[model samples]
Target: MPEGPSVRKFHRLVSPFVGQQVVKTGGSSKKLNPAGFQSLWLQDTQVHGKKLFLRFDPDEEIVSPGNNPLSEPLQKEWKEEAGHHQEVSEQSSRSPGGDDAVPSGGDGLRCLWGDTPAGGAERWLQVSFGLFGSIWGNEFSRAKKANKRGDWRDPVPRLVLHFGGGGFLAFYNCQMVWSSSSPVVRPTSDILSEKFHRGQALEALGREQPVCYTLLDQRYFSGLGNIIKNEALFRAGIHPLSPGSLLGLPRLKALVDHVVAFSAGWLRGKFQGRQQHTQIYQKEWCPAGHQVVKEALGPPGGFQRLTWWCPQCQPRLSLDEPEQVAPSSGARAPSTQSLALEGP
Candidate 1:
C-alpha cells in the first residue's frame, strides 16, 4: 500500500484538477457508477494518512443528454446501477463521520447519491489505495510484458475522470467511496503536518506495547508505515521488540526526533526525485558491519510485520539493564530539513 508520503504525492498529482469540471467519467468499478460524477466540479483535494479526499460540487450548467458524448447503452447501464442506491445524505445521517456508512453486507457497493445541495454544499469522494494501488494524471498505466503464456493487455483503470481542460485522472486498484465528512480526527497526528506534535507522539509511545506495534498505530502516528517504522527504529538504535515502557524518556525522545527527521527527509528526497538509501531495511549488514536480523515482530494475537535491525547496533533492552542509549553508526546530527518543508 502507498504510505502517507506516497499518498501525499498522489494528492499533488490530482491537485491540478481542482476547480475543473468533470466532462466525462469511465471506469471498471462495479461499486461506483462513474456517470454519477459527470457535470460535477471538483472543489478541493485533501490527504489524511493513506486516504485521499476529493470534494465535488454540482455544476450550474448541466449538459443535456443530446450533447453528452457518452454512448446511450453505457448511460442506461449507469442509470440502472445507480437506481438501487440510497442517497449519501441519508446514509451519512445514520452514521455520523461516514465511518460506518459503507454497508458491511451485500455487494459492498455502498454508493449513494443525493439531490444536489442548495447552497453549494459539497460531496466528498474518499480514496483508499490497496497494495500496489496508484493514481495517474492524463495517462493510463502501461501494460506489463507478456509472461510465458504470451498474453498481455493494457491495464483497465478502476476509475477515470476526463476534465474540461482535456486532461484526465486515472485510478488503479483503489477504493473510492462517497463520504459525508472528513475522516481525519487529529490533524497534528500526521507526521507530515506542520502541526505534528512530537510530545503527543512521545506520550503515545509510552504505552506498554512493543515499539514496533505502537509505531504502526494510526491513532498516534498518522501517515507512518512499516518503511518509516523500520528505518526510524534502526536510526535510533532501538530494537523492534523493545517494550515502550522499558525505553526511557531520553531514548523515547530520540526515537521521536528520528521519526520526524527521517519522515521529513524522505519526503524531501521524494519531492526532489532522489531515492533514499536504506541503511538497514532489507539489508544484509548494518553500517557498523554487524549482520542484520530480520523477523516478524508484533504483539501476541496481533498482526505481525517483518522488521530488520542490527542486533549489535539495536540490542534488545530489558528492565534489568540500566538505561543506556546506543550510538547508531547510521545516525547523523539532528537535521533542519524538516523545517524546510512546511506540512500540507
Candidate 2:
C-alpha cells in the first residue's frame, strides 16, 4: 500500500498531464467506461490520503450516465441547455453558484477538462489505486518500468486517457470508474504538509488502537502503510502492541516526529539515488544483531499484515502502562513537543 509520502511522489510523477487537453478517455473499470469522455483541459492533480484526484477544468455541459457525451448533436444540445441554465442561475444569485463543481468517490479512474457545469465534476479522473491498481500508459512507459510494472504495451490496458497533444495515459489491471460527487471529510493532512507536524501525530497517537495500528490508520496518517509502519516502529524503539492511550506524551510525540521525518527523507532519497533501502520491513534481523520476529498485531480480521520487529529494540510492554524506551544511538528519533491541541 502506497502511503501519504509515496502518493505525494505519485502526484508529482503524474503532473506532466496537467494543463493538457483530454482528447479522449476510456477505461475498463466499471466506474469509468465508454459512456462519458471528452476533450477537457487537465488543470491539476492532487492526493487526499491514498486516493489520487485529477482535476479537469469545468466543461459547459454534464455527461448523462448512459450517453456518449462526446457525440454529435447531443453534445451540442447539452452544451446549449447547460449554458442557458448557467446564465439564468448566475443572474439569479450574487454568490458563486455552489453547483459549479461536483466532488467524487469510489475505486477507479476519472477525467475532467475544467470547471464542471451544474451537476458535473471538476476532476478529469478520481483514481483509487487499490493495493495492486495503478495508472500507466505508453506515454508513461519509462515511469512504469521504474515502478517495476513491466510496460503498458505488454498486458494491454483497460483504461486509456488520450490527450489532445496526441499523448495518452493508460491503465492496466486497474479498477477505473467515475465516482459520485459527494460531501465528506477527507484526511486532515498529507505527510508532506506542515500541517502534519508533531501536533497532528500526537493527536493520532491518542487513539485506542495499538501504536502500530494507529499509524496504519489512513484517516490519520493518510499514506502510511505496513512497510513504513514496521520500519517506523523499529526506528522509534516503540513496541507495536503498546496501547495508544498508554503512550507517554514525550515518547508518542517523538515517535510521530520520527515517522514524519522518515517518510519525507525516504521520498526524497528515492530520486536522489541515496541508498533507498528498507531497514527491517522484510528483513529477518535487526541492524542491532537481533533476530526479527513476525507477529500479527491487529484485531481478529485475518487481514493483519505481517509485522517485523526486533525484541531488543521494541519490547512487548504492558498495555495498561506506557513504557518509554531510550532512543537507540544508531537510530534517528527527533524529540518533539505537543501543541496541546484537541484530538480528531
Candidate 3:
C-alpha cells in the first residue's frame, strides 16, 4: 500500500493540475461515476496523511445518491462552512465549505462536479488513496497491464477519480473523514505505539519487534503496505521476525525516525534524494556495493510479504540478546517522565 510519504508524493505530483478541468472520465463501478456534472471545474488540492484534500470551486457538483443534484441550498451551506473545511486561496472568492455540503449519508460513493457563478468554471478534482489504493494518473494503463486481475470493485477503492489523462485511483474507506481537522496531540512520539494501542492497525501487527510487520497496524502510520516495511527493515539491518518489543530502543527509535523522515521527504516528492540509490525500494541489488540482497519469505512475520536485505551490508544480530535494557524494576519509564511535565 502507498504509505503517508507516497501519498504526499502523489499530492505534489498532481498539485500542478489542481485547478485544471476534467475533460474525460469513467469507472467500471458505475456507482463511482461522476455523471451529471456538466459544468465541473477544478479548485485546489491538499494532502494530509495518506489522504488528499481537493477543494473545488462551486463549478464541480457532486451527484449524490439517487442522482440528486447538489442544489443552491447545499451550495449556500457549503460557502458558509467552506472556510473551516478547506484551504481557500486569497485570490479566490469562493469557499470550499464545511461538513454541510459534503453529505454524511447515502451509499457514500456517488461523484459529480459543478461551476461557480462568477468564475470561469475553475474545476477541482481530488484523487485520494486509502491504506492500499492509489492514484495511477496516466500510469493506470501501466498498472492495468502489470497486474492483470480483478475489476474496479475487486479492489476496495474508497473513491474512483477521473481527471483528464493523469487521474487518480483512490483506495481505502472514508470512515474517519474528519481526522484531518482534529487537534494535534503533544509529544507525538511513538506513533507506532499510538497506532498499536488505539486504532485499527493493531489487528495487523504480527509477532514481536524486528520480526513485526509495519502494515499489520495502519494506526502506526497510514499508507504502509508490505512493500515499505519489508524494505525499511532490510535497510535498517533488523530481522523482520524479531519481536516487536525486542528491537532495542536505539534501533526502534531509529526505525521510527526513518519512517517519519522518509514519509516527510517522500510526501514532499523527495524519495530520490532521501533514499540512496542502493536502498531504492524494491530494487534487486544493493546500489551501495552491488551486493545481491536476497528476498526472504515464509512462516515468520506473516510470511506473505517479501523482505530484501544485503547480508554483507545489513547483518542480523543474535536473537538471544535483547536490543536494550528496560529502565528498572522500580525506575519510571522515560516516556512517563516526559508526560509528567504536563501536570502541576
Candidate 4:
C-alpha cells in the first residue's frame, strides 16, 4: 500500500489535469459509471492520506473546436486515435440538461483557459488505492510479456479519463466512488500537511497500545503506513512492541519528530527521483552491525503487520525500569518542522 508521501506524489502528477474537460471516460470500474463524467470539467484535485479526490463540475457547453486548448494537428490525431479505442457511451451524446445530468456548483473551479459558468450540480470522486496501485498521465500501462503458459498478460485500467486537451489519466488497482459530501481530512493529523501538529502526534503516541500499532492508526497519524512506522522506530531506536504509554514523554516526542522528518525526507526523495534507503524495514542487519529482528506486531485482535528492528539498538523497555534513550547512529534527515512552517 502507498503511504502518505506516495499519495502526495500522485496528487502532484494529476494536479495539471484540473480544469480540463473529460472528453471521454473508460475503465473496468463497476462501482462508478464513467459515462456520467463525460463533458464534466475537472474542477479540483486533493489528496488526504492514502486517498485522492477529484471534483468534476457539469458545464453548460462543451469545449468548442475553436476554443480547444490542443493544437490543431495534435487535436486531430487524438480524435482519430481516441475514436478507434475509446468507449463510446450513450451519455456522451446527451445534452447537458438531460435527465442524467450531473449536479454542479460554483466553488473550486479554476479554468485553464478562461472563466467558466458554474451553476449545475458538482460531483466528487474519491479514489482509494490498493496495494501496487498507481496513476499514469497521458499513457497506459504496457502489456507484460507472456507467462510460462504462453498466456499474454494485459491489465485494464480501473479508471481512464480522456481529456479534451488530447491528454488522458489512467488509474490502476484503485477504488473509485462518487461522493455526496466533501472528504473529511484533518490537516493537523496528516503527516505531509503543513498543519501537522507535533504535540498532538506526541500525545497520540502516549496511548496504552503498542507503539507500532499507534503509529499506524490513521485517526491520529494520518498518511503513516507500515514502512514509515518501521523506519521511524528504527531511527528513533525504539522497540516496536513496546507500549506507547510506557515510553516516556521525551521518547514519544523523539518518535514523533522522527516520523515527520522521515516522511518529509521520503517525499523529497520522491520529488528528486531518488530511491529511499531503508535502515531495517526489510534488511537483515541494522546500521550498527546488529542482526535485525523481524516479526508481526500489533494490538490484540488488531491487524498484525511485519516489523523489523535491531534488538541491540532498540532494547525493550519494562515498566519498572527507568527510561533510557538509546543512541541512534542512523543518518539524520531534514526536519519537517521548518517545512511545515513554510506550508505545503
In model 1, pairs of residues that clash are none
Highest TM-score scorer: 1
Candidate 2 regions exceeding 4 Å error are 25-27, 57-124, 137-153, 176-187, 273-275, 319-321, 334-344
The alpha-carbon root-mean-square deviation between model 2 and the true structure, to one decimal in Å, is 13.8
lDDT by residue (1-344, candidate 2, tens digit) is 44554455455555566677777666544434432456556665655555566655445343222111112221122211100000001011110111112254563324432223344455445455544444543343222232244433333445677876667776544333344343232434444444444566678788777878777665566667787788778777777887778777877866766666666566555434454467778889888888888877665553467898887778766745455456554356543321111123
Candidate 3 per-residue lDDT over residues 1-344, each given as its tens digit: 34444554555455555555555444433333444232344455554333455544445454322211112121122211100011111121111111111322332423342212234332223344323344434433222222334433233333345565456533233322221121221212222122212222232233354443443344344444455565555545555556655555555554444444433333222324343222635666665655545455544434354566655544455657665433211111233322211111
Q: Which residue pairs show collisions in model 4?
A: 103-121, 103-122, 104-120, 104-121, 104-122
Please list the C-alpha lDDT of all candidates, in the order they appear: 0.67, 0.54, 0.38, 0.66
> Which candidate leads in lDDT?
1
Per-residue lDDT tens digits of candidate 1, residues 254-329? 7877777777676555656667777888899988898889898766766677889988888888778627656666
Off by over 4 Å in 4: 60-119, 143-152, 328-344
How many clashing residue pairs appear in each of the predictions shown? 0, 24, 34, 5
RMSD of each: 11.3, 13.8, 14.0, 10.9
Residue 306 error for model 4, in Å? 1.1
TM values, all candidates: 0.79, 0.69, 0.48, 0.78
**Residue 222, model 1, lDDT:** 75
Off by over 4 Å in 1: 60-120, 144-150, 182-185, 339-344
TM-score of 4: 0.78
Indicate the TM-score of model 3.
0.48
Which candidate, 2 or 3, would have the higher TM-score against the true structure?
2
